[model samples]
Target: MTFSLRRMLYEDRYKLILAACQDIRRHREEVAKTVIASQLLDALDVDVPSDALLSHIVAESLLRRIDRNLLSGRNLYLQVEKRPQIDLFTLLQRAIPAVPQGYALANQYLVHAMRQSSTPTLLEIGIGKGLQVVALLRALARDPGKIERIRVIALDPNRTALTEGVAAIDEVRAELPFDIEIYPLVKLIEVCEDADYAHFEALAEGSLSINAAYTLHHTTGPDSDARTRLLRRLRALKPRVFTLVEPSSDHDTEHLTRRMHHCWQHFATVFDLVDRSDASPDEKFAIKEGFFGREVRDILGTSDAFRCERHETLESWLLRLKKSGFVPYPEIELDVDLPEYCRSSVSSGLVRLSYRSVPIIAVFAFAGEAG
Candidate 1:
């Protein structure tokens, strides 16, 4: 056979092997285990079985490999190259009716923030897949003549994420009645960087308003100098308003406890609802053990890096803004209603879950000559 023919034959053989494996009784479970195991290996820079393995023994072995890889302390993203494309906006929209109370809280908070200025140029940090941006744009579409043109600059370090987000924004815009424009800023520009300051200043120099959301936590860590630097940079830009919405879990000594509780409560609920019971025992164990049990604990343990003092409480964040020479507005609270899968996990003891008896704070701060 010619080289091209041989290559085609090999490709066909691999596909046939995969198809054969799929015919097994526990095919779904097996596939899940293989995918997870392969991901773990990929993260570890270790070679794994690329050829199809049909035996249960092979599947069990792969699961063991995944457990070992996890024990080695690898990043989850490294292990799993492809994450499920979640339609976050659609999910949020569907969840609104079921959790109207929670939706009302978020809507009210967002409305109050928007009302702070007539033409706020919304800036979103960590614009993952552009879902939140799309939602914000949709909301803005309700009153196209609110005041003036809106500019959105989405910043992220990952080029792939930014590209995907931009594409998603374009896809969403095609379906919408409004013609809002979105700009993609791909540099991992820190709030503290001089270049960042210049870039932002140029964007906001003529714009009527400025705002940011859900992007502050990325700048936090044990390095107080870095944190201070970031704060100073943000203060310099002096955006008309800034809003931060983060996970409300405390990050002190109880970090692990909070994370475990959140994972068990939130993720476990999601798994029960979305995952199939017929999935391989290995796959089920992973969701229970690998993600909720291991991953959450690992992340919480690194609270110093992940925790934000400003995010700990809205009052504290508001106070910081005041101290920095910005007027603090009345803080609002927004609750993201958990999905049905997550709701199930909460009901079960799989995850520790709690709803703030009082309202959870989601504050906004205003700068410049506030109208």
Candidate 2:
């Protein structure tokens, strides 16, 4: 029966993972670390493996203090959903040496675009903590005298994160002179269709624009016709600019072996940053397990349509946008002289220019003559 075959395969993988853990005890080689990390990322993608599972994984895989310290936290899924611990991930993104430099990269684009328009309708997809956006609004407020007003439409499948984001924005409304109205809509962009966008026109007012920081990759596919459809809908809205912040790797593929390799390489760099950081042990573990670990699990454990963390590269992104009728801002080759801070970030290995050209976080102006 099919069930029997599935059970046999699962048992075989569990045995292999356990055996790999054993191998790590005897030899601390590059292969051993990769095996353990790959298996653990696999186990973590779907659900929290048992304490016994973690025990075996830790005993053989990590450094002494790190092994003991990593297990001291709650399950990866539960811990991140807590409103208070959300700050841990935020700190990792904005403060800790974050490679790809998502926090500041997106903020710069938003600030620059905001300055260009008197009343730009800023729409965001998957606004998690509302930290960077709030920072942006504050930066704009330094002008003080302009009666600035903009509408923010925060769309996310998780209403809880949206609620948290809205609450965070409300807390800062007093400090800024800008009048802003935030509308929270719950929808998965990948699955959403042309009909769903009927309301988008009404929501967008003034010089419409977008600020999507670390969220667009969740769309169901870099495959199927799904990605094309989604991009077309976005293009139809015709925002002044679409700012994207995403990882610069091929994590969205369905191939598990390739996925694990990409995951290991990407997270290794991230974990190194955590090790170098002044963040507390708990904070570091939270970023490692809750944020990065969840991304691995979501990418590997779920089918493409169901996965929460599907990501694509800049090349693929440009192609898809063009297919849907859009183009990268300025020209691909015409380099915008990034601020000295952005250039300096590359030395720390926190951010890098793609193709030795642009930052990992890029803003694409929709190439449409009208917004």
Name the best candidate (by TM-score).
2
Candidate 1 residues 236-336, lDDT tens each? 66655444443333222233323323322333333332233344444443333333333333433233444332233444454455555554434444344
Model 2: weakest 10-residue lDDT segment is 1-10
**What shift in Å separates residue 234 of candidate 2 from its native position after superposition?**
1.1
Q: For model 2, how does the per-residue alpha-carbon lDDT over 1-371 read when each residue is reduced to its tens digit? A: 01121222124444454454345445644454555454433233223332323333333334221243433442433433423435556667532433334556555555655666666667777777677678777877875333378678777788888788889889999987778888788876666666656666676654666766667776655555677677677777877666665666667776544554444444444554455566666666666666665565565444556776666665666677778876554422222344333342322112344322323443444433332
TM-scores of the candidates are 0.52, 0.67
Indicate the residue-level lDDT of 216 in model 1: 58
Each prediction's whole-model lDDT (CA)? 0.42, 0.56
Q: Which pairs clash in model 1?
A: 29-280, 264-351, 265-351, 269-341, 269-342, 269-345, 270-341, 270-342
Residue 21's lDDT in candidate 1? 31
User: What C-alpha lDDT, on a 0 to 100 scale, does residue 212 get in candidate 1?
Assistant: 44
Q: lDDT, candidate 2, residue 357?
A: 31
Local error of candidate 2 at residue 59 (angstroms)? 13
How many Å off is the CA of 91 in candidate 1?
7.0
Error of 1 at 118 (Å): 8.3
